[model samples]
Target: MQGDSRAFEAVIKSTERLVGQIVGRMIGNAEDRKDIIQDIYLNTFKHLPGFRHAARLSTWIGHIAYNTCLNFLEKRRLILPGENFLPEEEENAQASNAIESLIAHKQLTAILSEKLALLPPVYRTLIVLFHQEAMSYSEIGEITSLPEGTVKSYLFRARKQLKEHVLTAYKKDEL
Candidate 1:
């Protein structure tokens, strides 16, 4: 990635944040995020020459990352379930009040992520692209091969599903 120097660095600098955000939000494992990002750049470099003026270069890179993440998730579906999502060991160093708050926040985040993971990948993807990536409906549609209207519908449904899940989770906690 460093050999092409200026052009390559510029491409990475411009696109890396979105790639990281996409990969981080979509992929569950922190360890795998780095590898997936490296793979995206590698694929980008390999496919760069064939890239016609089809769409925005950033969108192209995002498509690559998005597809790669989906493939990664598909391949690891079985192994993922057995994985433990324990909170990090760093919590021990904090004060008791801070530790309690941290645990509560972590529990909420975990529940949300679990609920997010339950959505069909397409729905989850639209949510991530629209909300996390802040992409336009047309752009998300281009990446997903769906029409803009379809993208809007899916995003709406996905949000509704998440809302239901969050409320259900809180209700269960109350009981």
Candidate 2:
């Protein structure tokens, strides 16, 4: 990212999906989410010169993203409902669809998002980093400043609570 625009651009293209997934879940306002994404990249570029290979490059970028989002949250002092940041083109395609299964999938996604949004930011961040981002416990700990054991424990409780929430809602739906 330093002195090589091509390298920086390539990194941005490759990591766009990862950034989208992270910021999308945490920030409700699409505008703010977009701004935060830019901020993450800018911060990454600014600090690129000082980066040591203490962690994987992706992991380092993830740290920048994670911290940028937290700072945005702290400054805003507001948490909005979590959203599945589907690509705009895909969303447009889905909107034009007529298939039943597609409709059901959309509904399920919406419900799941609602349940996920109800979680506290910490648990939601843990779940996203662990499950959605496919990060290791150690990676998550590095980002969240939590010990690996604590990450495991919080993830356990988060999963349990989510499962209970889904089951109870489904039972009520059945009734």
Candidate 3:
């Protein structure tokens, strides 16, 4: 039992960040995120013995987190925000001072975050997995159960949409 507890602790330490990224991107509510993360960890512990070595441990854990979030969202009948999301006030805080370049960089990053929040959960997951986590298409496909082609296509669309939204928020003419 001590060995089991140590193994579980090691697993959580290694994969907690990956799980947090998935849960954070998919579920916006802080309270709901806590519940989802707890559920994910519980599920991971329950299923750990059954885990095969076919996939990377992080990828396997990520798959669990992604499915758990999907189930939670479905049960609650929640629809993640779509492209119609309004830009938050900070998005409009670009500066004109000597630090304009730095401020613009920060503003663009902020805009990307806001727009990313507006994407469908699938798109957000793909973006986070591919761009933020540096996972390849095959790895993402394994986690999402999407085909490699589908993963690539979805990632392309997500990037295109994010780019367009960011451009709209921070006008190209302003650069």
Candidate 4:
């Protein structure tokens, strides 16, 4: 039992960042994030014994995290926004203007982050797993339980959305 606990600890330590990234991108609320993360790890530990070595350990854990976040979102009745959904509250377009200025000031990374936050949870997850984690389409599909084609399609759409936002938000010189 001691050895089991130690192994589980190692797993948690190694995958902490990946889990953080997954939960962070999916969940906008900090308090909900904390509860969801705890629930994720608890689920991971509870099911660890049954885990087959069919997938990489990180991938398996990531799968759990992804599903957990989806469940959380579903329970809250909060659907991920598609292209037509406007953000719930924005007093004006200052946020957009601020992003543009951030781009003009050579803060491209920050500007991109702001835009990323506006994306739907699934799109953000795809971007994080594919770009930030450098996971291949197959691996992402496994974690996301999406077909490879769907993963590719979603990723392409996410990138396109981001591109459009960047282009329309600022003049070419700003970039």
Residue-wise C-alpha lDDT for candidate 3, range 1-175, written one tens digit per residue:
2239788899899999899999999998999999999999888888888887899989999999999998887787776434333333333333222334433657656667898987778789889988889999999998888899988887776776675565555555566
Best model per lDDT: 4
| lDDT per residue (tens digit) for residues 87-166 in model 1 | 22232222223323333655765667778876665667778788877899999877766789878987776776665655
Q: Estimate each model's TM-score.
A: 0.71, 0.76, 0.80, 0.83
All models: lDDT? 0.72, 0.72, 0.79, 0.83
Residue 74, model 4: lDDT of 83
Per model, how many backbone clashes are there? 0, 0, 0, 0
Clashing pairs in 4: none
* TM value for model 4: 0.83
CA-only RMSD, every prediction:
9.7, 9.7, 6.1, 5.7
User: C-alpha displacement of 52 in model 2, angstroms?
Assistant: 0.6
Runs off by more than 4 Å, candidate 1 = 1-3, 77-121
Cα lDDT for residue 102, model 1? Answer: 34
Clash total of candidate 1? 0
Show the colliding residue pairs in model 3: none
Best by TM-score: 4
Off by over 4 Å in 2: 79-110
